[model samples]
Target chain A: MSSSTDTQGTGAYAPALESPRSPYRRGKPTRSNWELHGWLFMRMSGVLLLVMVFGHLWVNMVAGEGINQVDWSFVAGKWSSPFWQTWDLIMLWLAQLHGTNGVRTIINDYAERDATRFWLKMALYTATLVVLVLGTLVIFTFDPCMDPASTLEVCRTGSAG
Target chain B: MATSLTPTAKDGPKRPVGTLYRGREGMWSWVAHRISGVAIFFFLFVHVLDTATVRISPEAYDAVIGQYKNPVMGVGELGLVGAVVFHALNGIRIILVDFWSKGTQHQRKLFWGVVVLFTLMMVPFAIRHLTFVFGH
Candidate 1:
């Protein structure tokens, strides 16, 4: 090691010099935009979610009777419409993916041990899969008239097929 | 003999190092964003499950949703909305920081703007929502 003055507060040891002929030990870089796309997706989906979530809160909680208005009938009424069905389907997908990715980043940051990080991420993926599939199915296969005693106009009049 | 690079008592100031982000507005907002995001994510799982109860029966769905209408859960709902609002507002701030030309320079102002707006919106919402919950 060469004798040198330390500028930053460490001892007088100078920086290590490397041989120009030293072979690069790092593995080849796999060209990918996965992380970049994930970053962009967060920003784009976040903007969309800000609008959609506000609309959702306005419709469900801020309008009419607020939380009291939420019930099975309310769900049936909203899903009965093709527009809300589509709205919710998109929301389900976007929100689930956004939330999953956000949590994955947090897991990466906090879970120091490799095994812990892997298991935690595995659990997160499993739960996300279940919620996404179940939520989508619920929206698609919803039988608004499933209840024989349903008071909905379509259900009561037997117009629903 | 191995030489260590650790600084001695005569090296410099005795103050501790690191924590570059401590006590800064940017740091606090980042912390809040992470926290609120995690909270919202966990809530989403429960929300999806509750909504899925619709597929079971109307009676089943109402039975569960009924729990949220009470005064206690009503207040909890207010907090949840508050968290959502904060997260959403700060998220926009983060976007501006990334995209806007002067965003980094005025980030502190933007954070205060987020705080003010959050308060302005939440006040009316809390009043209206509480009225709905309690007046009924």
Candidate 2:
């Protein structure tokens, strides 16, 4: 090791100095790959949402008598078709995922404490799961023509009956 | 006078004093995405409530739907459509940032791309939406 001994202080002095080192340090690996997947999901979901949302608009607003024609019957009719069912299923799934991922990212960025992050995410995930599952169930399991006797008066209309 | 340097002090962890500046891409994109998400969420609440009107009373349901038939509400629908369009478009931008390592490099471009695409896509769709909803 080449040592520079310089005596230029008040007395003849050479302070031993530690070797110079690089400031860069190794960082812990992040689950950024998963985040990357989620990112891709947002874009794909956005594209799908565009289609579902626009198609929904066109059908509800322009295709038929437009907004005036949309009623309980109209919804029932739409839900009756397997095509609309699938469309709605896709929309629900994508929207939930897109929204959930967005919130997840927000929580990760803002929740500084581990406990806070955990609880917030638990709540978020719980709400998301409940809504998504319930929505999907409602869309698919909806009985347009329920028993008139047990249903609302509107469902018991002569035309409906 | 002799002052000894302590190894522990020299090796002590340097705590960041202020907000750590992670060399990330533009913060505006994140902020926009967040704002749009919140906006969409707000609309979602209203939408679910409005749709739930059907369960209350058919007359009430029809009344709510009729409210949407007005010119003012029609304009509001246009704005809602715009919000969804922007949020979806910006969401895609956020996704691109997540997947591509080089995405941060083109953040400005991506942001502008989303804006342009949103406008182009939304214009025709919006016109069709308005006409369809209110034209007849």
Candidate 3:
């Protein structure tokens, strides 16, 4: 109400009046609850991301020999453990979903054209889906001993090398 | 005429402007918050792909992550750390402000607290991370 009355001038930086929180242009009030859900998700995911991401950085780059020690065998060793695998899996899922939703908000706010907004979000979701699927597969399906041509000590054996 | 010219917000005036942040600190903090968020989002894209490389072969995965060992990439890593730290700290501040009863009232003070904590958390980290990269 107040926002509608306040919108009169136009400029490059001009923001739109607050749109009524209803899908129907002039119908009954709707309770999609999506905005609330997204708000809560961002907060929850932020806390989890802090722990997962920092732990990841700390283990991979801070402990032991740091980044230099990270090689095929290093990853193989880590992924061998169920704890690390699940940690990574949760990190991957939460970060992707959280980041995708954030970008989606930006798109909705800035992309004025409906078609542009739709296509851009489509691309974002597509990229996110690809990463999520590929990362999940890589985490769960990885096998250090899968390669025959590999000369690594671990790859020589078939038993959880 | 006086009432009309006064432009009461609910009068459906020709121009409706939503409330915008006026404080300099708040504005800058808001900008940094968004930037850090976007940066993390972009990093996640690459990080996923890089991590996925592990699936190919140990050699492939090792080689991919190894590329980040360089000084240039080290600096980029520092930037990434900065973004992450800022985002996380600021995010906590935001959560407090939104959820805690007294948070919004002292949001300005809380922001400064974030900055102080950020410095404490990240400064030593940046120094160490850089030292690790260059010391090698």
Q: What are the per-model DockQ values?
A: 0.61, 0.20, 0.44
Per-residue lDDT of model 3, residues B1-136, tens digit only = 5542366756656653333355455677878988998998998899888878878776787778888889999889888888988989888998998899998788889899989998998888777788888988
Candidate maximizing DockQ: 1
Looking at model 2, the pairs that clash are: none
Q: Rate the local accuracy (lDDT) of all candidates.
A: 0.89, 0.71, 0.83
Highest-TM-score candidate = 1
Q: What is the per-residue lDDT of model 2 for residues A1-161, given as tens digits with 9 covering 90 to 100? A: 22344445445545556467735546886645787777667777788887898798779866777666887767766765789989987887787778878888888988999999999889878767766766677676665664343354445565663
Tell me the TM-score of each prediction against the true structure: 0.83, 0.62, 0.79
Using lDDT as the measure, the top candidate is 1
Clashes of each: 0, 0, 10
Task: Predict model 2's lDDT versus the native.
Answer: 0.71
What would the TM-score be for candidate 1 when compared with the true structure? Answer: 0.83
Report the lDDT tens digits of candidate 1 across residue range A76-152.
Answer: 88988999999999988999999999999999999999999999999999999999999999999999998777777
Instruction: Name model 3 segments beyond 4 Å from true.
Output: A1-29, A146-161, B1-20
lDDT of 2 by residue, B12-129 (tens): 7554333212223356656666887867765664565566555555467677877777778877877777777777777667667777798777877888898799889788867776
Give the candidate order by descending lDDT.
1, 3, 2
Clashes by residue pair, model 1:
none
Scored against the true structure, residue A92 in model 3 reaches a CA lDDT of 92
